[model samples]
Target: MAFHCYLWHGDTATAQGPKRDTLCGDLSMATPPVLTRDWLRKPQSMLRRKASTPEEAVNWLGEVFDQHAEKMTHSQVTGIRRQDRFGSALTDLQAGNDLSWGFPLVGSKYLALAVIVVR
Candidate 1:
């Protein structure tokens, strides 16, 4: 499927596959070549927290994710999917916000996430 570039209204999907029957895939690129979190960080898994203000949950979350992503899943596909975005469904999972990726099928063990962003 061709990569569709839309404004970051915070309501677009990072990936949209072809018909259910469609196969082989390649996502067109965006500038700055989306970097993995590991690549984004240097010399360490965690970047020093600029601030740990508990009152600003967003701050703590940003730091936690920045560090965790630096250590875990960092695929370009995943990174680019998140590059222009701030948080991941993964974050919610860690924060006890929402842990379900969703069911692949009704009540299926697998979960799904819908992220919308662009850069």
Candidate 2:
């Protein structure tokens, strides 16, 4: 199964990279970080989602990751350390701070998300 990757910043989000088996490679080979860095450099490329509250924004991202993992991997992911990291980043975003979180999916493959407050 392929893992979908997304980058969410402010009120905009976009799917990153092509759909492929993302859980079988090293971090250096992962596409999420590269796509995220590119997006951060050129954020105007991102499309806006419908207006939503901060909590809803966070929940939407969490649900996307969780639901994808459950559906594709056939296992529920809960109480994982990565969830805590994502929660911390969400808190930082709510606090008006920029933050980034990296999650190891399987093997050396990783997923990275950042919440950057662009002036």
Candidate 3:
């Protein structure tokens, strides 16, 4: 099984993109990158991670950050009380709200690959 994530962009009500101010105001913003043929070239890489829950997704992201973005500060890396960046994202997701417009992880690369695995 593959991890399934839905990225919300534009407007669900009017079918338009989010307001510029709304996008610019939010701190933890994340938009799924456009799926490209180059990413598809290594099909197995996507399958390597198949998160079955929000917690699993957060764990996967944390592991990725630890491995790739070690230079980040302690606050950006810790998962204390589930109130960290990833934790906030999880809260938003659970409330049926789309993850706002920022990278939930520590690296710029993750912002481009913001896959939201929900089950």
lDDT of 1 by residue, 1-119 (tens): 11111111111122222321121121222211122221112222122233222223334444444543433434622645553444554353334331111112212121122111111
The candidate, 1 or 3, that scores higher on TM-score is 3
- Residue pairs with backbone atoms closer than 3 Å in model 2 (clashes): none
- TM-score (C-alpha) between model 2 and the true structure: 0.44
Give the per-residue lDDT digits (tens) of candidate 2, residues 1-119.
11112353221121233433342122333233343333344333332232234455566567656644643232325545666846775676567664455544543344445544443
TM-score of each: 0.23, 0.44, 0.41
Clash pairs detected, candidate 1: 12-116, 101-111, 101-112, 102-111, 102-112
Ranking by lDDT: 2, 3, 1
Worst 10 residues of 3 by lDDT: 7-16
Native-to-model Cα distance after best TM-score fit, residue 79 in candidate 1, in Å: 3.1
Scored by TM-score, the top model is 2
lDDT digits (tens) for residues 1-119 of candidate 3: 23433323232221223453454233334322333222222234343355666666556655654564464456645535434667786665555443323233333233333434333
**Candidate no. 3 TM-score:** 0.41
Stretches of model 3 off by over 4 angstroms after superposition: 1-32, 35-44, 71-82, 96-111, 117-119
